[model samples]
Target chain A: MQLFRGLSGFSLTPTDAEGRVQADLLGRLLQRIQAAGVDSLGLLGSTGGYAYLALAERQRAVRAAVEAVGGQMPIIVGVGALRTDEALALARDARKAGADGLLLAPVSYTPLTQEEAFQHIAAVAEAGELPLCIYNNPGTTKFIFGEDLIARLALVPNIAAIKMPLPADGDFAGELARLRARTPDGFAIGYSGDWGAAEALLAGGDAWYSVVAGLLPVPALKLLRAAQAGDAAEVRRLDAAFQPLWHLFREFGSFRVMYVIAELLGLCQLEPPRPILPLAGEVRPRVEAALQGL
Target chain B: MQLFRGLSGFSLTPTDAEGRVQADLLGRLLQRIQAAGVDSLGLLGSTGGYAYLALAERQRAVRAAVEAVGGQMPIIVGVGALRTDEALALARDARKAGADGLLLAPVSYTPLTQEEAFQHIAAVAEAGELPLCIYNNPGTTKFIFGEDLIARLALVPNIAAIKMPLPADGDFAGELARLRARTPDGFAIGYSGDWGAAEALLAGGDAWYSVVAGLLPVPALKLLRAAQAGDAAEVRRLDAAFQPLWHLFREFGSFRVMYVIAELLGLCQLEPPRPILPLAGEVRPRVEAALQGL
Candidate 1:
């Protein structure tokens, strides 16, 4: 199976006031994103607060997402953990829950070497028959996958694609070129920095792992459609309109700001997990202004 | 209780091949460190692989340390976790297991705001009667406690000393002076960068949170004793002697190298928890050379 390509929308795991996963609400949100023309549905992505959720809660989330999407689009479940055994267990559970593919990050409290990381992904891939997409967000994982490591990991069976963060130095075109040359064929390369989605898509990246798409799917789909059609002018026009929201994402992290935006749009009525409160103070006003502009 | 003051040795949590905590081995190791005259014992520290271990394993390690020490010295237990409720549970368990104090790090998969972190720590402190030491290891925790936040947290009742990493730029004296001026009286400040410990001690820092002290306690204690006596010449002499081990630490990280060194000395037979493998290949020779020099 083609694990993921084109525009993949990450769905937020809506929770009740007591911090339990509200699967019915989550299913509704997934239906909304799927209706907006996302190529795939990514549940329990970083935006979904997968790391913060317990194992049972995460399994429930996958079940709800699969039930909601109903095979209309591929459901990719995030199955990353701090240990190999835990990640393997999650991968098997995700497969059993009817997830189409698994998305994993090197979730760690301690730093991981390239060899250790390779072994970890290999073990998880072997645990289930589902394809896997490697999520490389160094900001959260604190472990960057260099071209050599990515190429090495691509050789492992069932390791299908990679979702990479935009280069901090703003060299998206160069980094994308390097990744294309380094990774083997049949391996899709995607970009996840929402602010750089347009540039990355224009540079021939396979997918935009979008946060905004989960909340405001219509606009996000429009931008992706423009990029896919090679209409640079239209892509720029839409990107310019989304600049205010992107600015908010840059100031406060996308994870926090995405919650506020979702709440404002009435897409979901749940708060972000603890230790990750919503935007407030000076940033809150700016987020409101950005949403109004959107 | 005063919690900790001069040299505090962080004990390693030894595990069997199946990754079960070997309490008997851990207890024996604690006894050796105490015999070396450490002022306090730190169980389940970063060196102790606290984040990698489950709650029950951590509790068992603490129980063993307390039993081994038998009130010979204070045993501070690390009780940090990704969730506030988990941290609170650990704090309460540590107290029940006869730990003298609690050590908390703002362990988060999602980044935490100052207000959220303050609330988390405050909740943990309120859950238990033991004193709390704020651990600020940005390398692992990824959240540094700025002066303003530290000052605010210091005001929280039962929040005692801070175990800080020496500044990466090697400005221990400058950072120590700033922390001293900002925090309130009686809030002891400790330093944890093993290489720069001598400089921090000379700067009038309250404690040395030593990783090496857990294994090679006599040498670690001698260096601390020299610094305490204001014997700059002896301190530098010992620092020079430990240079090889410090070099290994800089290259392969202290956590990985320390595990190898411990295994080499037969202090513990277990490897580091998953995602953090023991050192090998080209680095193994260098680590061996460093240990032989010691």
Candidate 2:
């Protein structure tokens, strides 16, 4: 199964002002990725704003996405919550809603000890009873995993993959080689930072767990394929085309910028939930221009 | 109003394994703070494990806390949530439950803009219709408040105080002076790092929003009183006795150590919710020793 490999497109979970999951709109979003033939659908990942949605809404999102394109591609649902039991409950909910795998980030209010994180991940992986990806997203989750911890987790049941942040050093080859040497055979390794995906993929990362592909899967897939084919020049051309949007993503946070991209694409007109404002002022036209030649 | 002044003792809201609030145990904890004659009670702050709770559970904690010590001392409730609307709801809930004031940390999943944080705080302040404290805890909230931003928030109606982490340089007097110059008159500026309370209080900070005061109110009160009286020698003596526990708090987060303290004090045996494990092994005897000299 290509469940944890290749280009995994992450879709946003659209919601009204009250934060209710707009299931139909979400279906529309998922359909684009399905038709684009991305390897998997990452429903309710960070881009999906799973952290903002309630459990029922998250389940609603998973159900809607599953019905939209369950068999067409593997559906990896993000099941991260601040509490262990909550994440476990979300894992079960996603599985029952027909999700194919789980993505768990150690979402924290209290900075966790290494032991706490290991126990939490292991317990969730056990209870989830589905293939899982350890979401090493320190930017949002604020829990940095030592390579030792990640290697240890790689040995746990159902813990089949990892989605890493862009390494600060940008030495993707060195990092990938190190991780690959430690993790088990066929344990997928993916990159999530959109700006770094080109290098990560070119360095032979197992997958590109992408935010842009959620909105622009065809172009993103083209870039991914170029990297897979070792066409560094072609990859650079496509990556250059994405540079402006990547700038916007880095500046405004891809979560906020994706909302603008959705509206610009004429796909949906929605704002992120409160405390995360949508981009206003000069950002819109920049987003329009960013999409002009893509 | 002394609502946001002097020593505000924070209390832990005990919960069962499923994250249900133990209202009676919470009330018992609050009564100790009240009986010790602390200036105010900070309910549902970080030590209370507020982030681990559901909105309904958080409201239940506030209502129980207010009922336990409503008129006896000012009850300042922590009303932080990931969503702005959720926080507004919590602010209103705290007010409806008879809380005297509100403390809001810019609790986030996505890192927020300064404008977003300002707008969120303002909206909650307006809706809460009560004095609120900016919980300037970058350590957990991961949202740093700039001096300019703090000055701007000081102008927001009903936003009356701030609870700061210990400054990186440990220059309490200099930081207090700078913030005091920027903020309006009578807007309280306090600190929460228990190890720094003596220095902070002696430096003329308006309050000490204390975690140790939550369970060990009597000794904490003595330390607060000595600092307030400008008795440097007495404050030093009191602070030294607290060194062992403060050492434990720094080594293991105070949230984990508090459970051990509670167990030793014969108050309650409840563990912190999962993902924040209890301190174990040699730590128990160390805690016992810390209390012996105190």
Best candidate (score: lDDT): 2
Q: Best candidate per TM-score, number?
A: 2
Q: Write the per-residue lDDT of candidate 1 for residues B115-152, one digit (tens) a residue.
A: 88888888898896788999998888888787899988
Kept native contacts, as fractions per model, are 0.62, 0.80
Docking tier of model 1: it is medium
Provide the lDDT at B90 for model 1. Answer: 92
Alpha carbon lDDT at B202, candidate 1: 83
Clashing pairs in 1: none
lDDT per residue (tens digit) for residues A1-294 in model 1: 335788889888888644578989899999999898788888999899888888888988888888988589888889998878788889999999899998999988877888888888888987967899999988788887878889998888999899999888877788877877877886898889789999989988888999988888888889999999999999999999889989878777788888777777767655677666767756766777877766
TM-score of each: 0.95, 0.99
TM-score of chain A of each: 0.95, 0.98
DockQ of each: 0.63, 0.87
The parts of candidate 1 lying over 4 Å away from their true place are: A17-19, A281-289, A292-294, B281-289
Q: Cα deviation of A25 in candidate 2 (Å)? A: 0.8
Name the best candidate (by DockQ). Answer: 2
